[model samples]
Target chain A: QQPVQSPQAVILREGEDAVINCSSSKALYSVHWYRQKHGEAPVFLMILLKGGEQKGHEKISASFNEKKQQSSLYLTASQLSYSGTYFCGTEYLGSGANNLFFGTGTRLTVIP
Target chain B: EAGVVQSPRYKIIEKKQPVAFWCNPISGHNTLYWYRQNLGQGPELLIRYENEEAVDDSQLPKDRFSAERLKGVDSTLKIQPAELGDSAVYLCASSLVVSSYEQYFGPGTRLTVT
Candidate 1:
């Protein structure tokens, strides 16, 4: 099943902050975050495996809540290069295999 | 190291025609995946392979879609009499192993059926 993401689209100015949320109905074991630019492949940002554990890459970070079956991505002081579609991939518990069900996506646009 | 490689970055074919896509996973990677993504949407898993065997293909349309991985390295996906609805981006991805969480994706093949 696909996860649900909040704020289908967002617009922000440079130096601003944004938060994207992803929620799943089923129990989850891990959550992966990726960003895709136009006409490009999805690039991995980070992955959260444990509940309440947070991981960061540069100014981008993400957290996974195993109990709530949700994950949140935080972008601090956004830059123009941050403009892209962000996708959250979820791996459910008891899946036995490493299969990811991705969310719809969150379109983020950063402006000067 | 090179990421997953897919052939024919773009393809345009008429309805009822057959089409095929090829993929070569990263060396030493034991897991490969095929996903189809429609515009403005995320990638949907079509099939997954562990080594040379297909471990999951439930989402694949068996009636017209078929896939094969030989020697646990290269893979090919074929569609017979493709329909207009099949127009989408086919992506190939690979991970170090079946239990690995990080997946590297290729540029993807864009298919347009008229």
Candidate 2:
């Protein structure tokens, strides 16, 4: 099943921060985040696996709560380049397949 | 190293026609994935290949859609007798290993059904 992302869209200033939440009804093994601009491919941001391990690349960080089947991405001091649709992909641990179920996505716009 | 490569950045065809999209994954990447992204939505798994095998294609519409990853390096997705609802962007991605968290995506091929 696909995950559910909160705050369908968000607008922020250059120096502000934004948090995107992704929740799923099914159990999760890992969560991956990506950003996609219009007419462009989705760019990998970070990944958070089970055991509450948090990973960060640049100002973007993500935390996974395996128990809650939820993950949140934190973008601090956002920049113009951060404007894009954020997607969270979930993987089930027990499945034999390696496919990732993605969420609807959250559109983020950073103003100057 | 080059990322995934897809041909025909854009294509427009009438309904009931046939079209194909090609993808070349990064070298040495054993796992490749094909995703279809509709407007305002995230990419949905269409098929996944490990080496030269298509391990997963449950979401792919078998009646009109089929895919193959020959020789474990390149793949082709074909849609026969396309329908109006088949318009979307086809994305190709790859990772070094199976189920890798990070995936390198290509520019994607936008297909429009007339």
Candidate 3:
């Protein structure tokens, strides 16, 4: 099943903070975060393993809660370059081979 | 140092025409995936490949959509008799494994069917 992302869209000012949430119905082995600018490909941001292990870029951060089957992405001191569509992909264990199911997405606009 | 790459950044075709998109995964990556993204929506997985084998293709429309990965380094997705509804962005991504590794996406091919 695909993960569910909250807040269809968000607007923030430069240096502001924002959060994007992703939840899944099934147990997830990993949760991935990606950002795509207009007319561009999605860029890898971070990935959180089932054991609550988090890894990502230096500027973007995310946390996974195994108990809740959810993950949240936090953007601090947002910059104008952060404006893009954010998506969270979920992978389930026992689903066989590595496959990713992505959430709808969260459109973020950072005004400078 | 190079990321995933895709060709034909944009395509325009009439209904019933065949359209194909090509993708080259990152070097040394064994896992590859194809996804379809509609406007204003998130991407949906179409198929996945582990090496030269297709591990998952349940989401692919077998009647009109087909994909292949011969050498495990590059892949191709084809839509025969393309329909207007098939117009969307076809994205390809690759990862070392399905576990905790990040999947790097390539600039998708945007198809417009008339």
Calculate DockQ per candidate and list them. 0.79, 0.77, 0.76
**Model 1 regions lying over 4 Å from their true place:** none
Candidate 1 reference-contact recovery? 0.72
DockQ of 1: 0.79
Docking class of 1: medium
> Per-residue lDDT for B1-114 in model 3, tens only?
999999999999999999999999999999999999999888899999999999889999999999999998999999998999999999999998756688888999999999
TM-score of the first chain alone, every candidate: 0.95, 0.95, 0.94
Model 3 deviation from native, Cα RMSD in Å: 1.4
Q: Write the per-residue lDDT of candidate 1 for residues A1-112, one digit (tens) a residue.
A: 8999988999999999999999999998888899999888899898888554689999999888777889999999999999999999988888756799999999999999
Query: lDDT, candidate 3, residue B36?
Result: 96
Tens digits of lDDT, candidate 2, A18-76: 99999999888888899999999999888787785688888988898877899999999
Give the per-residue lDDT of model 1 (tens digit) for B28-53. 88999999999999999999999999
TM-score of each: 0.97, 0.97, 0.95
Query: Candidate 3 - CAPRI tier?
Result: medium
How close is candidate 2 at the interface, in terms of C-alpha RMSD after superposing the true interface residues?
Answer: 1.3
Clashing residue pairs, backbone N/CA/C < 3 A, model 2? none
| Per-model fnat list | 0.72, 0.76, 0.83
